[model samples]
Structures are given as structure tokens and as C-alpha cells.
Target: MKLSAIAAPHLFIPPEWDREINHIVIDSRDVKQGDLFIARVGRDNHGERFIETAIQAGASAVVALGEPGFRCGILGVPIFSTPDLLDHLSDWLHRAYAGVSQLDLTAVTGTNGKSSVTQYIAQLLTQMKIECGLLGTLGNGIWPNLAETRNTTADLSVVLRHLNDMAEQSIKYAALEVSSHGIDQRRIDGIHFKVAVLTNLTRDHLDYHGSMEAYFEAKRRLFVGGNIGAALINIDDGYGRRLAADKDITVPVFTYGHSDKAEVRYHNVELNARGMTATLTTPWGEADIVLPLIGEFNLANATAAIAVLAIQGFPFESLVAAASTLQSVAGRMEVYVKDNGPLAIVDFAHTPDALDNVLNALKPWNKAISLVFGCGGERDRTKRPIMAVIAQAHAAQVWLTDDNPRGENSDQIFSDVLAADGSDNFYCIHDRRKAIESALEKTDKDGIVVITGKGHEAYQEISGTRHAYSDAGVLIAQGYRKAGEDYVA
Candidate 1:
């Protein structure tokens, strides 16, 4: 494709030269023969510094997102610049995927249920004999074949590239977890979503978003800005109701919740550590759905996924039947148990509400619960104390440790956590591994031990270093297998 043809429409200053290009590469190391290297403003340093390396790596041309009158020092290849490149990035980034993007995409946004809803949607689609690709905190790739990703939502360039790859691999459906940071950063601007889902909104990412309203506005972009075909809003949440009531959103909006007001309502719920069974009332017809997923919040997540599939024209009864077959998402109420061993769970419940939900959901287990949890350093300090209080409220014992301190003072993070709770049954063990081991050792064999904040995560980050670690790996290393791992040989 011609560079001019790819960029002219999106760029404020149209491309003057019509150089042929094969691919668009953001990283200099990824440049190959016939690839157009894009030097954009990165987090740390300007991408301009990598131009020479990209050129040497066989880049066909260079497009630099730089300041006005910015000069390209390298002379071997044609170089271009645009001061306002970020504004039009998604458009041109998507141009590379024009012929490849055939997947019907669903982008799910929320504070907590993004991963579960997206994963559930993918699982349900795959059960229907339809190939589905998923991109989120769990990883990025086709269902059950995902590779790990750094963020819940990938950068726009990576998003387009991954979508193109999924399309090439014959994946006709994709469900992506859209984070507030991703939306606020314009990482999802150009991808037109066939279905958009809201799981619910609560306190999270306040450090980055500054306020709840700003955080909400970031998520609000999904339904309002994108080429959204239909939106599934969880009217159960105040923010969801607010977003649904907004007059500016022009798309056909559908509501899903427990009440009759919801166009796709669900009721008659039975919950336990094993999973849930509920009757779903949808526009197509009513059907009972069962999911082997823990937490009452998962009911909402599953409902959102079911509503999305129903809106996409899948047979309602078939979807209801398939619901029971959907697998549990990693790190989201992920359970691990063996005969005579404790009922253990690993979940990514980093916020106050998430922790409360996970802990409270385990009440029907009919066993004493010991929780290992902590606040992430340098993130929404206000939630720290609240989480500590919530943890104590739900568990028989609370173990406090680090959750990705990331250069913040670990002592300070814990101090904030204990600011509210100055009582017994609260144990402070700074070492995460020790905290988990201690929590497990203290709980009886029949009791439940839950680890929160880092589910499915492979490493623990502290003071800028990430040590290789995993909550499930720690359990398995101690002779306990992953919740669903086969033991029959």
C-alpha cells in the first residue's frame, strides 16, 4: 500500500510522497524490509532517537510524530513529521488492517468485570463452534491459546496488528477488554465495535483518572465515540444508568440487570463456590443459564456476555445451554482444591469493592476464610484503608503484603492500609510468598484461603523490579494443583 494512501485521510497534513509500504512498526527493533517505521512520542523518550536503528533494520520509510518544524537527522530514507499525529494515529494504524479486519468485535469496559465479561463472551462464542479471539488482562490471542500481554488493552498499533493476525487466522469474532487508560489514551479510537458492554463502575484507577467522574468519562467514550453497533449497559450500576440515560449517545442502547426495567433481565439466582444458575429474560425469549464461575459480580458479567451474544443474533436457548459449559477466567475467582486440602481461590481483586465482593461471595462455602491481600503501591491510596477494612470484614484472618509497589515505599503503602483497622486478626507480612504461605498454614484443611490482587499475574513488582512469581504457582509448588488441572494419568 502507498504511504500517502494510508495516511492522507487521517493526517491533518497529508502525506506528499507515495512510498510503498508493507507494514507499520512502532518499535525500531521490529522494523523489517518494506516496513514503515513510526516514531511516535513514547512514555520515556521520543521515538525520534530510534530512527537510525529502524532505518538500519530495513525500514522503507519513517513517519515521526514530532513537534512542528521538527527535522529528521537521518538522510538515508524519506522521513515525514506531523505535530498532531496522536490525534490521527488510530485511523492510519487501522489502515494496515483494512483488508484483514473481518472479525465481529465486542469491546467490554468497566472497573472490575472487563476481563470476566470479555473472556465469557469468547468462551460462549467458541462453544457455538465459532472461532473467537480475545485481548485483555488475561492475555491476547484466540481462546485457550492466549499469550500474556502487558496491559488489559494493548496500544492502538498493537491492537490493530493483533486484530489483523486474528482475522488472518480465520477468527470471525473478538472480545476485547477496554480499560479506562486505553480509552483515555485514544488506544481504541479507530476500532469500530459491533457490540459494547458495561459490566459496572466503581472506585478504581483514581490515581490516573483523578476522580470518579473522569474515570467514568473515559469509559463512556466506548459507546459514544466509536462506531458502536449496539450497547449493553448494566442498569444495576448507577454509572451505567447515568450513561444509558445520557441523550448524546446515539446508538441503540439495551439494558441488562435483575429488574424488569432491563431489556435483558436475569433473576432466580443461586450462588456458591462451585458457580451459579439463573434464569435470563432477554428480548429473544427467556432461558436458564448456568456458569461455573464464582462471585455474584460474575452473574452480572455473564449476563452482560449473554446479552451481547443475544443481541448479535445467536439463538437464545442455545446460548443458555452453552452458558454452563463456559470456563472460569484465570485469576477471577479461580479455585484450587484437592481432597482433604483447603478450598483455595486466587483473584485479581485489587480495589476495595472487588475485594469485598470476592470475600463476601465465599460465605456459602461453610468454612473459615483466611485472606491474603494488600494494596498496590502508588495507586489510589484512599482505597487502601477501605480495602483493609473490607478484607477484615469478610475473612477470619487478614494477611497484608505488597501488591506491585512499583517504586512507591512499601512501608508507606501498608501504613495507609492499616490506617483504618488497628485490631487483632490482622497480620502484616511484607513478603508476599510468606504472606500466602502463612495464610494457608493458618487455615484448616477444610477452610478457604483466598489470595487477592494478583490473579493470573506471573510476577511481583516492587521498587521497579519484577520478580518471577505466581499465586497458583506458589500453591502448586506446595503440592497443590491448579483448580481444574486433571489428576488422572
Candidate 2:
């Protein structure tokens, strides 16, 4: 596109330098030849400081967001000033990718279960011969054919491009995992969502959001403001209930849960070592589901996906049949068990509520449980000690291990997590691999070892570098079998 097309005024475009732009880049390091670098001011520093670096990196033009939100001027090297370029970035992105496909999208948002819910939707649809693309923490694509994404919700430009690619592949439906950060930053601003699903929200990401209200406000933006076609919520959650009843949500609201208030309620629920069996009563029809996934939270996640797909006009009987073949989401209640020893579960339960749910969900086994978990460094510090207390209360033994202790002292991280004046049940293991081994080695034949935080991740980061590591890999090396292969779990 031409410089005059975006800025309109001659003053906003440098004289004799209206060069053709190739790509719209925000980060200076990502700039390339003919790319238009956007200097957006952030919380720590302004992007104008990186303009020189961007230029050296072959950026064709630099358009910086005006300090007071709206202004226009000329700068060196085909540079220009625009009216809050960062704030209005989505507008330019929509224009740039105007021909991109707008698939029937369903954005699943919450602190936990975002990945599980989104993936379950994609998995179920794929099983029914529907081409559904996925965009979330797991990756982006159709089913198992996925590529890595930098974030759970990617940048607006990447999202548009990915959706367009999926559409080109003839995939008409999409499932998206929308995070609070993504919603707050307007990364998914131009998405035409068919339905917005809420699993539940709890204490997570308080560091960036500063408060629960602010965190919820970011999530609230996904459902309200006339952006989505319908709202599907889990009424069992306090926050979900608040959002369901919130006057700001102008769209039709559909509720799901075991609660009486839920429009799409599940009853006669049964849980066991194999999976969960439940009957779902929805506005469309009824479904008798038998999922191969463990955890009551998975029950909620599965139901949310089933309800949303039903709302999209899929047959209830086919969905009910598809439910029986549902596979466990990667790293989510993924089981690794010994021949006659303790059962080990690898999960991504970092938050207090998620940890609690995982522990509670494992209670049906009626075995002595050993837990190995740790909070990520430089994150919401308040949750660290809280997690310690929960671990001590739930498990017979607790191992506090390293979980991405980036640029933070390992000793300091453990001390914060082990905040108690007295810790009779805590064992500090700074090494992640050793922590998993120790936690498993000490457990009895009938016991269970639950590993939380950094699930499905292939590496462990300490200091600044990520070292290759996997909890499941460690267990398999120890002769523990995967869940489906004559497992003892």
C-alpha cells in the first residue's frame, strides 16, 4: 500500500519517500526490507527508541503513535506520525487482510480450561468429518496437523493470515483460545465470532492485570460490546455467573453446568479410572457422553464444547457418539503408570484453583498422593505460597521444584513458594527432573504422583536458556507405561 493511502495528509508522509510497504511490523527485531515499522509505546518503554534499530534491520518506513493519541508529522527515512497507531492497528490490519476468510469462530476464554475446551471442539468436529481449524496454545491448524504459535492468542496479523490459510484449505469452522492478555491487547479485534464460551475464571495473571476486576474486564470484552453472536457460559463459576447476568452482554446467553440455573445442564454424572459418563440437557437436544478423559474439570470442558457445537446445529446423536471416542487433550490428565507401583499424572495446573481441581479430581482413586509442583518465576508471587498450602493440604507429600525460574534466584523462588513458618510436608527440589524422580521414587505401589505446571512443554528454562525436559519422558524412562498400553492407573 502507498504511504498517502494510510496517512491521507502529505505532512504524515515524508516528501519523495512514499515507498511501497511490504509488511506491518511492531517489534523492531522482526523488521525486514520494505516492512513498515510501527513504533508503539508500551508500559516499560516507547517504540520510538527502537526506530534506529528497526531502520538498521531494513524497515522501509516508521510510523509512530503520537503521544497524546492523535497527531501527524514527518520524520527522517520515509517516517511518519499517525493518530495512535497502536490503538488503531486492527483497522490497518483489517484493511491489509480484507480478502482473508472470516470463518465461523468460537472463542473459549477463562484462566484455565481454555486450551482443553478449544481443542475438544476441534477434535470433536474433526471426528465428525468437519474441517475445523484450531488456534491456541497447542498450535494452529486442522486437528493433529498443527504448527507452533508464539502465544495462546496470536497477534492480529498472524491470526488473519492463519485464518485465511485455513479457509484456503477449505476449513470453514474454527475454534480459538482467547486469553485475557490477548483480549486486553485487542489481538483478536477483527474476529467475527459465532459464539463465545466461558469455562471459568480464577486467580491467574494478576501481575499484568493488577486486580481481579481488571482481569475480568479484559475477559468481559470478549462477550460484550456486540462482538460475538452468542454467549455460552459455565454458571457453576462465580465469575461466569456474574458475566451471565451482566447487563452489558446484549447477546443471547446460554448456560451449562450441573447448577440448576444452567440452560444446558449435565446430570447423572459418573466418574472413574477410565473416564466420565454424563447426560447433557441442552436447548437443542440431549446427549449421553462418555469421555476417555479424566478430571471433573475435563467434564466441564467437554460439556462446554459439546454445548457450543450443538448450538451450531450439529446432530445431538452424532455428537453423543463422537463423545465416546473423545481423546484426552495433550498434557491434560495424561496418565503414565507403573506395572504395580504408583500412578503418575502430568498436568498444566499452575494456578491455585487448577491445582485444587486436579488434586480433588484424583481423590476418587483413594490412594496416598505425592505432588511435585512449582510456580513460574517473576509471575504472580501471591499464588506461590497459596499453592504450597494447597499442596500440603491435598497430598501426603509435596515437592517444590523449579518451573521456568527465568532470571530469578532458585533459592528465592523456593522460599516464596515455601512461605510457611513451619513446613513439615514440604521438600524443596530445585532440579525439575530430580524433583519428579524423587516424588515418584518415594510413593508406594498403591500411591499416585501428580506433576503440575509446564504440561506438554518440551523444555525447562532456568536463568535465560531452555533445557530440553519432559515429565512423561522421565516417567517412560523409569518403565512407566502410557495410559492406553495396559496401564495401571
Candidate 3:
């Protein structure tokens, strides 16, 4: 693209230096010949400090959020300075990617269930013959096929690139998982969303957000002022109730849950080893639905998915029938068992609320519950003790293990978890692999073992590095079976 096409007035491109820019890069290390480097200040450091590095790496032009500390004009390269570039970045991106296919986009935000809800929507849409893509924790792409991403929500530029690709591929629908950090950092600033779904708000990311109110406010932005076309929320959540009570929401609101006040309410809910069956009641219509996933939380997630499709004009009956085929998202209450072997579940339940839900959901099983869980390092520490308490309250045995002890003492993390004073019921095992193996060895054939945190995650971060690891892989290597595989013991 030409410099004149996407340039803001703050960016003064000299007539002599005017040239086409090949790529737009934020990180200095990624700059290359013909690339436009954007020097924006981040939470901890200013990108301007890396201008020299980008220049040396063959950056065509340097775009700074404001005046740099050093001289740039003397280098004979065009330097454009704009104050608060992040505020207008999305607009610039929209203009740069003009004619890109604009899909019907839905954004899901919450501490828990965001992954399941977004993935379910993408799967539902695709099964209905609509070309749809999903962007979230598991990865990004159309239904079953996806490429992994570093974050639940990628940088605004990365997201745009994916949207551009989706457009080129003729995909008409996209479901995005929007996280509190992503919203607070303005990573999704420019994307226009047709529907905003809030699964539920719980105590999480408090270390980054500083407070629950701040965390709530960050999530609140997506449903109110920005580019929301509709708001689909789980009114059962306390924060969701607050969001729904807001009379200021200009977009249409669709509420779902077991509450009678909910527009999409479900009753007669039943959960088992196979899946869940529920009697769903919605504004459009009602039906008994069966989803091949476990837990009341899954029921809520499915209800939220149903609400999303209903708003998109899909028939209630079709959605009901489609409910039977809704596949389980990776790591979210996933169950596996081998013949005569203990049933093992792997989940991404890192937060206290999520852990409680998953454990409670397993209450119906006849087998004794053995819990394997741990908190991530450098995260919200307050939840560690709470999780330990919840584990003791629910499980017959709790195995506490290291979960990505990045830069923090694994010993200290375990100490905090053990502080809950459930020493009688819990064991401290610093090695995650040993922890899983120990849990499996101890649980009887009639029991069930649950492993939480780091579900679908391929690596464990420790000492500022990611080491390869997989919860499911470890189990499989130990003679445990995959979902559809029969156990030969």
C-alpha cells in the first residue's frame, strides 16, 4: 500500500521519501526492508527505544506515537509522530484493509467458559453450512482446522490479518474470544462485532486488572460503547446481572440461564458421563436439547450458544437438533476412560470459580473424585488458597502440582496452595508429570481423576522458558485411553 493511502496527518511523509510500505510491524525485531515500524509505548517500556534497531533492520519508515527521545530526521529516513496511536489504530487498520470481507462477528468475554462458548458458536455455524472461523485459546480457523495463537485474543494487527484471510477464503462468520487483558490493552480496539457474549464474570486476572471492579469495567466496554451489535449474556452471573440491568446498552440484549427472568432459560437439566440433556426455553421457541458435553456450566455455555444462533435467525428446532452434535472443546471438562480403568478428566479450570464448577459437576458420578490441580505462577495468588480449600471440600484426594512456575519459586507457589491447611487431603508434588502419574496410580478402578489448569496447553512455562508438556499425552503414555479408544489392560 502507498504511504498516502493509510497515513494520518500526524505522519508527515516527505515527498522525496514517499514510497509503498510492504509490512506493518510493532516489534522492532520483526522489521524488514519496506516495513513500516510502529513505535508505541507499552505498559512497561516505550517502543521508541527500539527505533534504531528497527532502522538498522531495514525499516522503511518509523511511526512513533509521539516525539522520540533521539533524533531521527538526521538519519535520512521519514519519521512520523502521532500522539496516542493506539486510539486510532483500528481506524487506520480498517482503511488499510478496505474491501476485506466483513463477516458476522461475535465476541465472547468472561473469566470462564469463553473458550467453550466461542468454539461452540463456530462449530454450530459451520455445521449449518455457513463458513465460519473461530479465534480463541484452542486456536483460530474454521471449526476443526485451526492454527494456534499465543493468546486467547491476539494483537489487533494479527486479528486483522486473520480476518483478511477469512475474507479471502469467503468465510462469512467469525467467533472471537475476547479476554479482559486483551480489552484492557486495547488489542481488539478496531474490530467491529455483531454480537457480544458474556459467559460470566468471576475473580480472575486480578493481578493484572488490580481489582474486580476494574476487571468488570474492562469487560463492560465490549458490550456498551464500542462496536457491539447485540449483547448475549448469562444473567445468572452476578456481573452479568449488573450488565443486563444497565439501561444504557444501546444494542439489543439477549439473556440466558436457569433464571426465570432469562430470555433463554433451561430446566430439567441432567448431566452424566456421556453428556447433558436439558429442557431449553427461549423467546423464539423451546425444546429439549442434548449436548455431548458434561457439567451445568456446559449447559450454560450451550444455552449461550443457542442464544447466539437464535439472534442470527436460525430455527430453534434446528439448533435443538444440532445441540446433540456439539463437540466438547479441548480441555474443558473432557472425559476419558479405558475398560476397567479409572475415568480421567482434563480441564482448563484455573480460576477458583471454574474449579468449583468442574468439581461440582462431577458429583453425579459414582466413582470417588481425585483432584489434580495447581495455580499458575505470577498470577492472582489469592485464588491459590481458595482453590485448595475447594479441592478439599469436593475431592476424596487432592494432588497439588506445579503449573507453569514462571520466574516464581515453585516451592512458594505450593506453600500458598497448601496454606489452605488441607494438608490432610493434599500432597505437594512439584513435578507436574509425577503429580499426574501419582494421581493415576492412587485412584482405584472405580474412581475418577481430574486434572486442572493448562488444558490443551502444549508447554509449561518455568524460569522464563516454555518446556514441552501435555496432560493428555502423559495419561496416554501411562496406558490411559483417549475418548473413543478402548482400554486394553
lDDT: which candidate is best? 3
| Model 2 segments more than 4 A misplaced | 1-21, 32-34, 52-58, 66-77, 485-489
Instruction: Give the lowest summed-lDDT range of ten residues in model 1.
Output: 9-18
List model 2 lDDT by residue over 377-432, tens digit each: 87888888888888988999989899888878888888887776455558888888
C-alpha positional error of residue 49 in candidate 2 after TM-score superposition, expressed in Å: 3.8
Model 3 residue pairs with clashes: none
Preferred candidate (lDDT higher): 2 or 3: 3
- Could you give candidate 3's per-residue lDDT for residues 1-489 as a string of tens digits? 877667755355566777688767777876889777888888788987998888888887777887433234535667777775776667766666654437888899999998898888877777777777889889987777899887888877778768777887888888899999899888787677888999999989999989999999999998778688899988999999999988879988989999989989999988776777889989888799987777899989988987888898888888788778888788887777766678899999999999999999888776699999989999999988999889988899889999989999998998888888755568778899999889988989889899999888989999999999999988888887667522312
Off by over 4 Å in 3: 29-33, 52-58, 68-77, 99-101, 485-489
Global lDDT scores for all candidate models: 0.83, 0.83, 0.84
Q: Return whichever of 1 and 3 wins on TM-score.
A: 3
What's the TM-score of each model vs. the native?
Answer: 0.93, 0.91, 0.94
Q: lDDT tens string, model 1, 315-349?
A: 88888888888777878887777677777889999
Better of 1 and 3 by lDDT: 3
